[model samples]
Target: MVAEHSPLRVGIAGHIHLAPGSERPIADALRVELDRISDRPVHGVTCLAAGTDQIFARVVLATGGTYEVILPALDYRDTIVEPSRADFDELLARATRVIHTGYRHSDTAAYLAANRELLSRADRLVAVWDGIPGCHAASTDRTVDEARQRGIPTTVLWPAEARRADRRP
Candidate 1:
């Protein structure tokens, strides 16, 4: 259990398909939100997936905050595309702690389990969601809903200029 004076442990859930040029704005918004909690140190919790999760981890570290990683499955690294593999590996190495969900595959069940674990350990959740219902399982909206149900304080960040990129092949 965390002590009362421990750094605020903030969990992250966000979209992987970020628009071509939305990263900067979305990251700025995230920085703004995180800065609001400046009274205490920040400890981020993330799956380090490809888009917003990576961005959140970067912001946390860049701002002198630390973060932990939660892997959805043992083969989660294999699921990352070549382009994103470097970021994933880099962030994973810098994590203050790393946890695995004990699943062999990166599937919906594993993702849900990881999300559950993330929420269980976080004092708050930051969702970089667009407020749209997710079209598939293991989405930002689903995690946001779970966080809400668990009554974890949640913050949604969708900048006015932020958009989702087309899904990759």
Candidate 2:
């Protein structure tokens, strides 16, 4: 068992829209990778966006770790959270802490700011990327690059077949 004093802080970054038939495998892969990277279950820092962020939070909770959310934009729930997956609210509510970044929503700036917060606070980054750069500014590729530059140990969970056939989202 890992020492109680040393908890692993894991921040998640990945595609918001996951390809059909890919979510379970990706989550399993992420959990396995996180386990391999650290001796203990991890505390997840999530923005609770939709696909990837929510999955990481679930895995962290399943493994006996807590999670915290950082909202990048103002009125995030009113704008972005509504369209997210169904479990988003329950997960958000269950988060150990919630921080709303004062950055108002205007373009992708909010997400970018939240992503930065995730990286800065966590000891490790868990990226569920498809090895492709997403269209948005807060893409998984960009997150990976930032983590690398920050010298944060990262565990990227992208199975060979998990790559999306198309990047429509």
Candidate 3:
């Protein structure tokens, strides 16, 4: 049971792409994964970009938890948040806190910095990863590695089926 004072803080790192038909499973996996770690009130933190970040925010709300959105830049309203504008707007409106980092525009550097901020504040890291390392600074792999280096417990939610699909001929 939680102490009424401290809540579990969870940060998320994951791919921006969710396969055409994999939303439900991924969401379930994330829920299960987080459940295994803390039964306390979960305070989720993520940069609300597009895919996993949005899902994380939704899951937090669904679980009766709260969330904080750390925007990489100030132009989020016009840039990345446009495709899922309605959902983004709703999440933003419901966030426990909303923070926009330095600079008047978004960029790779800003995103990496935002990721660092999320990691720095989280008590744990939940990686919705593909187990593949890519070029992105804020890739799930990098975030997982950073969490490990910082001694924060990390939970991975990439189901085996997702990996199998990735290896299809």
Candidate 4:
């Protein structure tokens, strides 16, 4: 039975690379959590970055929900890696809406501003991050903290490992 707040508009953010080959587990968990929270289906927004963002968007789409994208920059070259460029192109085509953050360069200020823009439109935030400390630790962690400070309900999925395995080796 769908709850009164079923079908939530979730906002997703995470590290670009999280658990190299274990994206499925995190995606599955997100699916379950979203269902639990909304008591129904859930749609989400993603930045469509190579790792976590793309994976989350795919999961949302697979679950018969819409995936909206807020690109960090104006063009693909600024945010997408070479090998993943084609995939991003296709994903963009499938998005319910595509928002350009109006920044052409890949600067930290632009990225954070874009993150804020995306978070502003979301009711809840779903984040997949490696538990780490410090500002330069992870963008996902930083963004999640920002969301929390703004009183947005955030669900953070950290890999259940002995250490922060999400970090690049």
Candidate 5:
């Protein structure tokens, strides 16, 4: 847990697809929302996967905030896909803490368990995702729901249409 004087600690969740159009806007929105909630400054934690996770981490770092990484498995380098491996490595280097969830590379159960562990520690959750049912990103959805159930606040950033009116044409 972070010190009380430290900024709010936020956990970021989202799908792993890199659909370029939505990524930048979502990252910007998350940073803005986080800035609004913290008197000190906001810190972000992520698994540093491709797509939403990488984008969130990058934005947090860019905004002079701290980032922590909770890896899904002991050897995350071997588990993540190739293109994303470099980003993950970079995040690991920058993280304040890198906790390995003690799972093997091939276990889906371990990954979900790791996700739960990450969610358990956060003061709030910021999710960037499409509101799609039965998606592979269901873990993110589940994490947000579980956080809400535990009375932690959740902010979701996605389904761009709802926020389209605010965008510059």
Candidate 6:
């Protein structure tokens, strides 16, 4: 149980490629789940990737909550697409704090380490996953598994109409 005086620290693990037009519904689902979690002030933790992480940060802000960001690597910003760079930069600036994983490259190892760091700081996790098992360590499934292993309460949001895009933004 969370201490009465502490704000809930919620983490996110989700897909980078989400279907077009899925944003509104997904945001709604997040809002609902966040409400169910607690009325205590929220402190979100995310990597601020495109799609889900971006949406989660916005929702946290909307609810008058604060959030921190975790960067996967020193050069992680370079991996963001040019079109989404502005959003990423904006969210990064809005974060109450930022933690870097100390990796030199935005590779699989860096991402896994980043997620681990995120999980370490979080009291619970929100997974915008499709319930599909992943083949690799970087997938949403793997992150959820890690959270469960740590005994972090996890809420999975997969709206009925939610779909994933064929490519990354």
Q: List model 4 lDDT by residue over 76-146, tens digit each.
A: 45457666788788887999898888888766766787788778878889987766544552287788888
Q: After superposition, how far is residue 126 of candidate 6 from its true place, in Å?
A: 0.6
CA lDDT scores, all candidates in order: 0.91, 0.82, 0.80, 0.74, 0.75, 0.92
* Residue 165 alpha-carbon offset, candidate 3, angstroms: 11
lDDT per residue for candidate 3 within 16-92, as digits (tens), equals 76665666677788788778877755899988767788888888888888999888888866786456788788889
Each candidate structure's TM-score, on Cα atoms with residue i matched to residue i, is 0.94, 0.88, 0.88, 0.84, 0.84, 0.95
Can you write out model 6's per-residue Cα lDDT over 60-109, one digit (the tens) per residue?
Answer: 99988999999999999989986678999998999999999999999999
Higher-TM-score candidate of 3 and 4:
3
Candidates by TM-score, descending order:
6, 1, 3, 2, 5, 4
State which candidate, 2 or 6, has the greater TM-score: 6
Number of the predicted model whose lDDT against the real structure is largest: 6
Arranged by lDDT with the best first, the candidates are 6, 1, 2, 3, 5, 4
- What value of lDDT does candidate 2 attain over all alpha carbons? 0.82
Task: Give the range where candidate 5 is weakest over 10 consecutive residues by summed lDDT.
Answer: 159-168
Off by over 4 Å in 6: none
Q: Which is the winner by lDDT between candidate 1 and candidate 2?
A: 1
Scored by lDDT, model 5 comes in at 0.75
Q: Model 1 over residues 1-169: C-alpha lDDT tens digits?
A: 4577788899999998888888999889989999886565599999999989999999999888999999999999999987789999999999999999999999999999999999998989999999999876788898888899988999999999999997768
Off by over 4 Å in 5: 1-4, 136-138, 159-169
83, model 6: CA deviation in Å? Answer: 2.2
For model 2, how does the per-residue alpha-carbon lDDT over 39-131 read when each residue is reduced to its tens digit? 776788999877888888888888888999999877776665445645878898899999887887734888888889988888888888878
The C-alpha RMSD in Å for every predicted model, in order, reads 1.6, 2.7, 3.2, 3.4, 5.2, 1.6
Which lDDT value does model 6 have at 51? 89
TM-score of 3: 0.88
Report the number of the highest-TM-score candidate. Answer: 6
